[model samples]
Target: MSGRFQAAAPKAPSTLEKITKSPLFTVGLNTAYFVAGIAFIQSPLMEMLVPQL
Candidate 1:
């Protein structure tokens, strides 16, 4: 525990963090999720596994 070089604590969010939390980020995230959901539901593997799908 002596002479250990510890990293400093995290600072406040930067401009990049502010941009990431913007509405554009929310829309992008939601769109990505929607596309992934569609892909999962329409995948041939899912159809084969469910059989009744």
Candidate 2:
């Protein structure tokens, strides 16, 4: 039992860890995805509605 507990102890994270570990990274990623989705929605609609000039 004590051996299992020792084995399960948490290890420290190494350097070069991902910036996405932070809340700011998550927000930035979500914002980028939202903007991309809006652009995707608009592009096809604009092309279809505006045919030529």
Per-residue CA lDDT of candidate 2, range 1-53, in tens? 45554457777766535565878888998999999988977897767877685
TM-score top scorer: 1
The per-model lDDT (C-alpha) reads 0.92, 0.78
lDDT of 1 by residue, 1-53 (tens): 79989999989999999989899999999999999999999999787888563
Which residue pairs overlap in candidate 2's backbone? none
Instruction: Give each prediction's root-mean-square deviation over alpha carbons.
Output: 6.1, 5.1
Worst 10-residue lDDT window for candidate 2 reads 1-10
lDDT of residue 7 for candidate 1: 95
Best by lDDT: 1
lDDT accuracy of residue 32 in candidate 1: 100
